[model samples]
Target: MARIFTVDEARSLMPAVLRHADDFVAVRADLAELTHDLRHEGESPLGGLAEAKGLEARMDETLSWFDDQGIEIKGVAPLLVDFPALMEGVAVRLCWLEGETALGWYHRADLGFPGRRPLP
Candidate 1:
């Protein structure tokens, strides 16, 4: 079952969440760069493949941590996460993106990122 968090509960876990997120972002970026580099080079596929495999493993580990925490990763490029929350007894996602100092947005579970609204 998905974990439901209160506003305070989610904010309290921010430190750990952000730390895990940082690792996830770094590994993901490394994997992306490796992919791009491999695409441009025709001579050595094995070397890039090995590096990509390692990075992919690291990314998987990081993602697993998020899954274990019941936090939803909405995107990777910009690093967005959603904490399931209930507002006025209605289900909503507490939206957070990298570079933001605090959780400042939310959206109904049915709506995706585009429907994000500011937290009241």
Candidate 2:
């Protein structure tokens, strides 16, 4: 069974979540640059294929961290995450997207980001 998070429990994890999210963004950017360089120049100054592989591994590890925490990673580029939860006994997700300073939004399990509503 999935771990269901209370709003406060999810909120308490924000600090670590933000840290991993930042790291994921930085690593993703570096990997993109490396890929572009290799494609255009036949080689990159960014330590070649080995470094790219390392970056890929790092990205995987970051994602695994989220999974281990029972948080669903909905998107990579924008770093969207959802904590499984129940709102007034209805299954929902406590949503947090990149650049949001707090866990201030939610949506029904059947709905997605388009259905997001501010937390009451």
Clashing pairs in 1: none
lDDT of 2 by residue, 12-50 (tens): 999999999999999999999999999898888776899
Candidate 1 lDDT: 0.85
User: Which candidate number would show the highest TM-score if scored against the true structure?
Assistant: 2
Q: Please give the range of 10 consecutive residues that has the lowest summed lDDT in model 1.
A: 41-50
How much is 72 displaced in model 1, in angstroms? Answer: 1.1
Write down the TM-score of every candidate: 0.87, 0.96
Off by over 4 Å in 2: none
Cα shift from native, residue 59, model 2 (Å): 0.4
Off by over 4 Å in 1: 42-47
lDDT of each: 0.85, 0.94
